[model samples]
Target chain A: MAAKKRKKSTAAENEIINLTNVCKAYSTGAPALKDVNLRINRGEFVFIVGDSGSGKSTLIKLLLRELTITSGYINVMGYDLSKIKHRKIPKFRRNLGVVFQDFRLLKDRNVYENVAFAQRIIQKSNKEIKRNVPSILSVVGLAGKYKAKPRQLSGGEQQRVALARALVNQPTVLLADEPTGNLDPKNSWEIMKLLEQINENGTTVIVVTHNREIVNAMQKRVVTLKKGVIISDEEKGGYIDED
Target chain B: MRISSFFYTLKQGFRNLFRNKWFTLASIATISACLFLFGLFYAIVTNFAHIVKTAQEGVAVSVFFDDGLEESRMQEIGELILKRPEVSDVRFVSAEEAWESFKAEYLGDYADGFTENPLADSAHYEVYLNDVSMQSALVTYLESLDGVRMVNRSEIVATTLTGVNALIAYVSVGIIIILFAVSVFLISNTVMIGISVRKEEINIMKYIGATDFFVRSPFVIEGILIGLIGASIPLGVIYGMYNVVMDYVTTRFTMLSTLLSFLTVDEVFRVLIPVSLGIGVGIGFLGSVATVRRHLRV
Candidate 1:
């Protein structure tokens, strides 16, 4: 029995994120997430899909520790989201990379600076920044456009810059919230491809997206949420039509 | 808190200041105006206090002797007066010297009118004290001595000067408190505007795993710089104005210069420099810290 318990503990330790019956309620006393239990392991690529007000953003915020859970537990990268001290939140977040839907790149800075910004936040040495930034820019296929500002780049190129920034720190997990919401189909596909590439490279990628075509075509694990409850968890799944 | 991070935050702080140039300039101007008034009042009060000190030093108690007091006994009394701790100095004026001085002053052209010394019995000891406040004590002591006829003191002058000094101190403290508040409020407003302008940038920084110290350091630095720059401008202005005013007072008001001497620029700035800079930096730091705590939740 002790050996079996050790094996189960080791399995729990291997999971990058574990949410056991987690529930989150806002000030209005309405439940945003209800009895949610899910787990994503290392190097896994998973998608969280839900309609508006379906607790998708709330789940993301919980993983980021932006919101405290109303009940149950959330463990991200081994840090308990519910019990993590306020001062340790930044250090905890450093292990996770986040990409927003709006492509939140510093407009005044160029591609190189924007990518280097992530490295700078971690206080990387100048030599490391000079080395790592260009290497990451190259990975994002924006090495030649290092001097171009955000406004000078296309929507696809800007998203790529945001991706470069998110990946520069080599985080254990990459959380992309509607990362392709503002991009065209071609750009969105390119971003999804990059995310898949990043996951294959040994980073857990959890994306919250709404593009039905991309979701169906990707053939990845899909976790569907309806009215703050997980309705489906399927392997190689597509977007479930609610209508 | 690595040295590299320190430098980075320092660079960000300067960048923030330059990015919001208008707000920076406005804050500096406000701080300068406030310090300028404070400096002006400080200079006036210091000079007033100095003049009062000189006047107090000159104040003395005139101790007259009894009729037919011998020269040896008067000398003993002078020695006794000199032994008092509050007595700074003592000058005994003989009846002959008194008559001579009186004639030299009121009877300059009628010196031959006084054939003999009519003021022979007016000999007295002028007792100079270290502090004007000790006049009452010394006066009482002198009046109680044998062969001492009367002890006359400038009580009204001492009281008025002491009152004026106290009033100046109270007013200075009150004005300084008000000015400091106004300066802090202005700096807080400027920092608030800077924060609003960079709200999006700040949000991104917070999202990107930057600590509260990492994010707040730049604004705090910006505040300190504003304070330093703001403080320095008025010191320079006051330095020049002080010299000019001193020159005008010495040359333009020659009559007043003999009775009252203003402090040299160096003497004034020796205190003003540190105080103004300290206040400037203090206000900046306080304003930035307070605004950051209130507005920047992250």
Candidate 2:
């Protein structure tokens, strides 16, 4: 069964996500992540910056519970990552939202249906889905394009549809990995602005990206990685390419 | 899971059943044909067994008396046979009575066409045994009797029929097993195609926290529909065709009907219905579950 929807959890001031000395090593290669320690409290906007192979994707994967850590502890929303049952991983994932670079929308489904799918997975009633889908679409500026298929929409609109899908559940933490990678500069700024608004509304947001200009402009707390280890963590830090 | 979720998966499965028209049709066609052949073989094998069983039931030995024996002597012989431990029933039929029964049963109006009763040496003790396996020993004892001229028994016919029945059953089972395996493989491949068609959607679903059961339900539902439709076609066809053939054989081919009786379609489907439906649905579920499990390991 799906887990219960989470409460705000802000009153207790609990850390929403925690990773301590985490390590992930594949059999054929060196460690993808080494001794990574990080923590984020409620309603903070953070960015994870790294070059290719610097383990940004690996960190995102670890937080999503898609990859088992080789060692050390990771916890999110009071559930230990190592102790969570395999069948309950999906229930754990519902506490957070996820977005991707390519905007993974079901091509056969329209914008509204795409966003509503997340609710349907948790077995929401038709009445509830009806009430929630339109409101979420309005949040992502897709209220009038509910019937448009993925191929029929522009790239940014498709990403918006994906964002709507991710946010429809009102997740406590929003994890966006290269969300604006496929968009032009103007579209990228709009997506960043939306993420900023979402963070302001008492939700923790974590963005992983390679876009240096957008990172410098946002001046968010940035955790930079090099050679499978954290080199710097700072509040209001800009993306320094040379590390 | 909620009731609404159950309905959603069911409706999803129904809609997906028609998603790829050609693939669904092909799978159903193959399944129906396989099931039809299975039903046909079942009829033939069961009828063969029925005929063998009846022939075994009717097995008996006849003890005939000498031509010069007095009626009193024949009566003593009949009494002796009646006293035997193996004999279940012993009834004496005289030459005249035996001839009359023969003419009435085998000759019909053709007996009137004949002026004389042609069967002269038909008198005997029609002895039924408690067990067919004791027939040989009884025949030996009767042959050694004083007034007995001959012993007539259908042991050879019964033995041959029983053996043939066993052979038919073995061969039919072997064929059915091979055909069933092939049918299941074809069903698995069909579901595999459906999974491949929606790989991207499936990946997205998994990432968004759709459980394995939810992700797999639609395909399973489609599999069940295919199985249901596939089995019903052959069941209907075989039942109707069996009745037609049974009517023709029982009416027009009287001689063959006596020796080789076929099962009524109703009788055959008593076994066929469960077997066919089980095969259809079992394969469908197995295929879908296996494909989904392997494809969406996350």
Candidate 3:
């Protein structure tokens, strides 16, 4: 008989997320994720590695409450995602930072205002904005580019600004969806390193990527999805299967 | 949610209003022209009503007694007409006094050639009416009396005035409705254009957790500003036009001066300024709703 896998208890260190048999289906028949489960301990740097259309992006969207799971349980920051009210979505979002592949920065605003916008939504004090914005910009290597427009900056610089905005709120978890998808190889590595630095400071980092080079290089706990099923989840993983 | 945040929307609206200056001015011009026509029609209707009242006051019905009636019968008929509550006052004019007054006025031209006074020896009871509408009823009752030969009133003039009044009212109300519709359309469209142009910015505000009220308040306030500016132009024009019209009517139509007291400048201003503000505020509210509904999808 197969050994019974006991559910890991998260009540010890206050787990940030716990998912069990999470399944999502867009249509009546086909499933996006089939009988999948995930557990993320607090302050963990985890990478969701999969090929294109392997449901890695779907997992991030479900975690962020941007999309709903068809059937199964998802708990994020100790709140049930399925039971979250519509009005409470903003409050929930304020607690988590989401980075888009497309870099969803407001084109009309400058670098300073773009980062300041995140703090504005959370209703932070002027003194806090005055204090945190410069520090966050400096961390993202954009210290002196406060007045620069998004279009005026390089693609890499623009992504840094996006990261800075995500970091300014000091969220519980930072979800970066293909954070380096548009960057050059050098810029991509630089951004991954920045994410590593952010994770060291006590924020749970979830990076979704198909980049084999960066995935293998980071050597963090890798959860690999193959055809909507987690075929391999290891303590430490590599880019190619070591079969 | 806070007062400071509401100010932010207002500032955004004003900024947009200035940015889209041509569209704003076009809407204001449309609103001013419509309001001006409304004010002009209002002033005309008011003056027309004054004319009607003057005409009604001047045209009195005279109840004439028969020549052969006794003085006691004539006096009894006079007393009967006077007893009706609708009758304001009754004055008895004897036939001798009537002829004497006629001779004094027209004798120089033709009275010397007449052998005897052609005027009948009849009692003329000049009846004042408290209600103008009761003139026909009073005439019918007087004609049925024992000594009254005829109750002559200006029926032609009354009928004509009634027709003119109906025409004035129909035209005034029609014009007012048309102007109101056009003005409201202009205001709503102005706001619609404004919302469409800033739709992206508005969407970001929604995504970033701005409340519906915070996103909406600025457009409403902007509508109000547009309304106020639009209304001011017509208000000044209306006030100035009233003065010019008043002077013209008083100087030329001298007969009207004694019977009809024209509206004072202050009275015109009092009624018009409120109407202007009301239009401004009402349209502003409607325009704001139009804008917010279109742009602030959240």
Indicate which candidate wins on DockQ. Answer: 1
**Cα RMSD to the true fold for all candidates:** 3.0, 6.4, 6.6
Candidate with maximal TM-score: 1
lDDT of 3 at B29: 79
Give a tens-digit lDDT track for model 2, residues B41-112: 888878877776666656777788887788888898888899998778887887789888888888878777
Task: Report chain A TM-scores, every model.
Answer: 0.97, 0.93, 0.93
TM-score of model number 1: 0.89
Q: In CAPRI terms, where does candidate 3 land? A: acceptable
Range of the 10 consecutive residues with the lowest summed lDDT in candidate 2 chain B: B113-122
Model 1 stretches with alpha carbons more than 4 Å out: A1-7, B67-100, B112-123, B128-138, B145-147, B294-297
In order of DockQ, best first, we have: 1, 2, 3
> Model 3 clash pairs?
none
Select the stronger candidate by TM-score from 1 and 2.
1
- Model 3 chain A scores worst on lDDT over the 10 consecutive residues at A1-10
lDDT-based ranking:
1, 2, 3
Per-residue CA lDDT of candidate 2, range A185-242, in tens?
A: 9889888999999999988999999999999999999999987899999999989777
TM (chain A), candidate 1: 0.97
Candidate 2: residue A230 lDDT (0-100)? 95
Where does candidate 2 stray beyond 4 Å? A1-13, B20-23, B50-59, B63-99, B102-151, B236-259, B295-297
The 10 consecutive residues of candidate 1 chain A with the worst lDDT sum are A86-95
Q: lDDT (0-100) at residue B160 of candidate 2? A: 74
